[model samples]
Target: MTLSEDRVGMDPITFCDASMNLTYLGVKVSPWLGVNISEVGSHLEQVLRRVGELRLKPFQKLTLINKFLIPHFVHQLVISIPSRALLRKLDTSIRAWVKEYLHLPASTSNGILYATNRDGGLGVPVLEDLVGRVALRAGVKYLLSEDPAIRAMATHSVLQGKLEKLADSLGVKWPCSLTDLKRVRKQQKSNILRAWAAQKVQGATVDIFKGDSVGNSFLRQPSLLKPTRFKTALQFRTDTAATRASLRRAKIVKPGEDTCRKCGETQETLGHVLNKCRSMHERIIKRHDDIVKILSSESLRQDQLTTEEAMLGLTGENLKPDLIVLSQEAVFVVDVTVCYEHKGFVGMARQNKIARYTELQRQLKSRFNVTHGEVIPVVIGSRGAMPAETIKGLKKIRLASKGLLKTLSLSALRGSLELYHSFMDR
Candidate 1:
């Protein structure tokens, strides 16, 4: 009795069949279906094993997923395009694993988890979307190969005409290269983001390309701060995590308990925790005032202000900025807010300050007889959830050093926590 006949309950195998399926480089291939679905079980199994062995922080877990799990699946798709069904299965598995690892509620939305870290999300790349992007990149790279032999072979292929027409439709100029294609795709992506932001944020003027010296400094000098601080700063700016509001939104807390545990009058929302909630008022104000005082001193040393004149609202606009620096070239209007760590709240805090002071900046410029200045919006989280943009704003105004910013922000966060717990326990 041969092995085929002896196979108990398994499907019958055709012996000596030329068209029998074969496995190559982790992919299954058959003459009929061309490429049968490859088993991705091993890929996920490895990650699951690692996840089980180690107790990791939420951000650390995100790092593990991005560094280990994502690359495993991405490499496979780059080699052979998988079916959307398979891609979705992999994505679901990864997402579930991330939720479990982060100890988040099952109700956590994909938008929150998969959003870029800079945008107040976990920054988990969606597998389904990544697979498609990888496939597109592969096709474009191959189609635009510079090798004569490769071009000849690709031109003879069925996808050639379609790809060329697609490229043409994309407005690829004659004699275009791979670089040109990538540039066009990048521009398209930027346009999409602009459109999406405009649609989602009412009255939002999408100016992502606009150069602000403060944002540029934060982005450029990342090494000036610790990794955790940098990451926290980014989260605060984006309004993603480590805040009660964010946790509640992720369903990690009961809806009723979403109100301030100490005050019990207002919702425990980010804005409430940061700007309202009388229970934490003193700490919040102290945090802002401390940062402002530090920036004010620095501005005075730089000769940007007279005795922290602009910061004290003694010199201009009836507006008290955390600090203000008046240079020969420009005058900076700086304000400070200690925001909740939640992404939504961080964004609101920054935006509110900007909106509140937009007219103030105009007023200061006209009233004080100063020109060539900018508004510096500095927002920090009580528990070290500082905004990178805040640092940039400080630097733009020559107000605060990176070390000072980190120290003051973290101290404020610690102080706020002490007050919060005391209030709650009392």
Candidate 2:
């Protein structure tokens, strides 16, 4: 039949010869190869190679991963579902690159690499989970479309089986509608993935550390401005710092040599080097004084301030607290202590400081003619963990807690790093 005769009453149609692969809307599609997986891999390789040439710090590299690299893959992810195995391989490659760039050990937990920073991880998203999230979001959007044609197409799609399975796994009810699927996909699915990542770390037999109580506040505040210092502090907080103890755990050190080289008093853990080693006493005191100095400066701006000044009387016993601020309305007896982060020591140290100054609080209240008094304990962990009590204490003094917390955390972490180096050198 002639083309015009065939198309006389309808719009003209054109056909192209079939091929093994097709590129549509910026995505490659193949019946055999399926949806741009190979293209995505090649693209990632090129981008990562370019990225590696730059002298980026660990946090900067992490920023690039979260803000740039992941988003690059996510666009493809939303359009095409990659196999979990392939996504995991991609994740492994990215993680290895991260470790090399960050100078992290191969043994570092994948959870730590992928967990949110607020949850004590580096906050890099896992590729598999990212894909799952993207898929879930897209699936829900299609399944819940107000367009009846689109909705019906989705309902009968090959993806519907997979979507139903995912919904079931995510605790969404079967035979579900638009609203139910949307809620679970958007909110609960992401949380479940995060929890799963955290659980991987928590379930590990080694490298168990809680998320920083202050939620890694230093990164948000301008505390450890130097990238190297921030990296060191991050390593310390994540329990991946190359301390003698970790070296021994990694079997890089002789068992006997794991003892503190500076003091030879105990096994050279981060906690011991930061808090308990006798040889580190001077530096440790300086660390404590640095925090006290910050507090003292803030207190000086207020009504009346005292530092380690002995209080007379009280059954002939003299008391000297780290700081005392007396105002027209209240007296605050403040003591600063940096303790090992493990085993609830920060809390104990805080309570001890409060107890030690209880009688002094009474004395200051009466002597300073203030109507109210409190014993404030500024307790920070050696690895920069700050308890709520320290925050409360800072707030009571009208101090801007974010900057102070960052300063205190950096001081503690820097001191600990210095102590680690000093011990290692000896």
Candidate 3:
């Protein structure tokens, strides 16, 4: 008997007279039609539907997407290259689900959703970029395989073009050796993806890109009990919090009507409410004092600490810093200030604080008969952004930056949330 006839006799169902689609290991394979897009859509719809039925927080949903949904596409991606249009459609649907879960406005930037958590974003994975990474890694693996057939197939495949493009994008020369390509793949995998995300948010109005080095350790807190507060803080950091200014930008309010409802003197931006609003003066003082209390508890000795004492006698100016620490060798004047994170405001605040206390530093040294005195400005951003100045100041006082940053950020975010509601609910 012929080999075909023998195979047909051995498995009659497998050998058909007419060409037709077949399911092999749950993936639909056809002689003429290739991997069906409808199948992939159906799978995504089912997964997303199941996700919707679950009671999961926004962060948990993001974790599911990263850990489950993205991996679901990896096998298919490795089998065949999907079109970018399809990937974009899937991403849009997923982002819509995320927006609903987080109660975010449509005006919220997608970059903030896809950026790494350390970069002040929600750390949601981007489907398109994820696909590219998967494909590139798989392609590199096949190209470097020991099997001659796989190596030949990879050399002639479209993946070569992608590999060359990746090299060009990274400023590496094309037609690189196998060793060089493998080195690039190993070293630049995570960085290339992160760079893509960072580049996407470079032009964002709120500047959420925290860079690769400086991490927002607050996001890694282990507690999930305060998801609402976490959501509020996330919204505030991304500039999508329900402030009058954000409402105007989202077109939820009339144009040109974003003036501060409390103060009525300036536009009711987050900056205005958090730092400049007259009606919020009491709450602002409370926020400042709360930070003072934290610092006092962490860094101050009870016997040596002074709180808001008048310095007119020594400095000849009516200045009262937040806290004064009298040590045997040097006296430390620590003043705490929270300002908007944008447009060099934190640096400006730190400089102003130093200048304000320069004369007082000299006076304190003379009055206390200490060898040295320094003014430490604890400058925090209104949205919990820790500028380098804040880190330096915290280090100068021998405070643990991680715990303190988390505490300070939560305090600022809570205060901002209260201010937001106080104006909005009225």
Candidate 4:
């Protein structure tokens, strides 16, 4: 079925995306109204209570934790403290006693590392990743399930041109609503959202607007935004400016004040350092020679595929085909990606607008045809920079971004190039 605009959930809003597209699988997060809680504590308490009861069949199998649980513990780091008197007293008392009583080594005197955390100290699950996953689940539920409010919102978006609703209609082939517009359900709870539905197109239809019609809107550039960290509609609705603004004010980042050590020119931005500056470009060219060899050895046509460039299509319809690998017998389309978004950070996931990213990937995948048999969509994003939530949502939406294949971040491209060169030379 085609993706619908309303089906795209609040991820765009959470991540402050101007536009987004997403896919929702129909299995887990149906409109069953069973797996949602407004409060985090309440949700956790219910889960624990369910484990204790064990009588009622709770959805253990579908739980995110159960699906993507990790076995690791926190690594404890100690901040150095001054004052020889205090240090000496503690060392003579508790430190010496613990070492002697427990028969522990000198390194063990630092503290305890928990079992859950690989390095182990405080057993805290990564909260930001957890939030991002929650956001994804919410998006899935909002789209595939029978949540009337969400459905109404979707419907309104379809009725409006904000979303490409016709795609869903074409893809799914089902009439959206069973209700008659003639009847007025004044008191119905869903009516609240129905009233809020994006207004109907005024006396016009989308069929007239043809493809490539929509110039840049919020879905494209979000030019209206003043380059702020948090500009999504959800932030405005939830009044989270203070919280979001704090991130923009973070001093964790070192200023981009590095003059190129080699060229004596100012250097900044990962992209500029890696791709643009002439000195770095020369290094990259030197490195790419190795990649060229790999491509030749594989007997596959080689091409430089940049993550930023769209896949190009040689057909009637424009397509941004990233890499076209052809070997007389087979053809394959490859899409390379690098993400700069700080999704792995503690709070970045829940608030990510990954829906748009998910949709774009799907569209690119769908466009592949000239390829041999299996139309390959090669994708790679940073291990930590991309949120687990984004990955989960993308998988659910059917545009999975896999990493098992060789993927090197632009930051490490130089190293990767050298490694590739070394291996090939050997």
Candidate 1 per-residue lDDT over residues 214-315, each given as its tens digit: 322333344434444544444433344355666676677867777676677866654565557887767666767776677766667777763234322324
Question: How does residue 129 of candidate 4 score in lDDT?
Answer: 27
Q: Rank candidates, TM-score, best first.
A: 2, 3, 1, 4
What's each prediction's TM-score?
Answer: 0.59, 0.83, 0.81, 0.23
Better of 1 and 2 by lDDT: 2
Which tens-of-lDDT digit does each residue in 198-315 have in candidate 3? 5422223234336512325545541422677677766766666777787887688898898877778988877787788888888888888888888888765435656677777343
Better of 1 and 3 by lDDT: 3
- Runs of candidate 2 with Cα error greater than 4 angstroms are 1-17, 20-22, 30-34, 42-46, 169-215, 219-223, 312-317
lDDT of 2: 0.69
Candidate number that wins on lDDT, 3 or 4:
3
Candidate 2's error at 135, in angstroms? 1.8
lDDT of 2 by residue, 1-426 (tens): 123334535775332233455667667676565675676776887777778778866667767877888887777766776567777787877888887777777776665566555555666777776666556667767767899987786677567776666556556754565666567545643463355445332323112234553536655432344666666665665566766777887789988888877777788777787788898788889888888887787778664666678986457678788888876688888888888776556667877887777988898798878799999888777767766667777787786466666677777767777766676666
Quote model 2's TM-score: 0.83
Cα lDDT, all candidates:
0.58, 0.69, 0.68, 0.29
Q: Which clashing pairs does model 2 show? A: none
Cα error, residue 182 of model 4, in Å, equals 52
In order of listing, the candidates' clash counts read 4, 0, 0, 26
- Give the TM-score comparing model 1 with the true structure, all chains together: 0.59
Query: Which candidate would rank higher by TM-score, 2 or 3?
Result: 2
User: Which of 1 and 4 is the better model by lDDT?
Assistant: 1
How does model 4 fare in lDDT? 0.29
Q: Stretches of candidate 4 above 4 Å error? A: 1-258, 263-271, 285-322, 325-332, 337-426
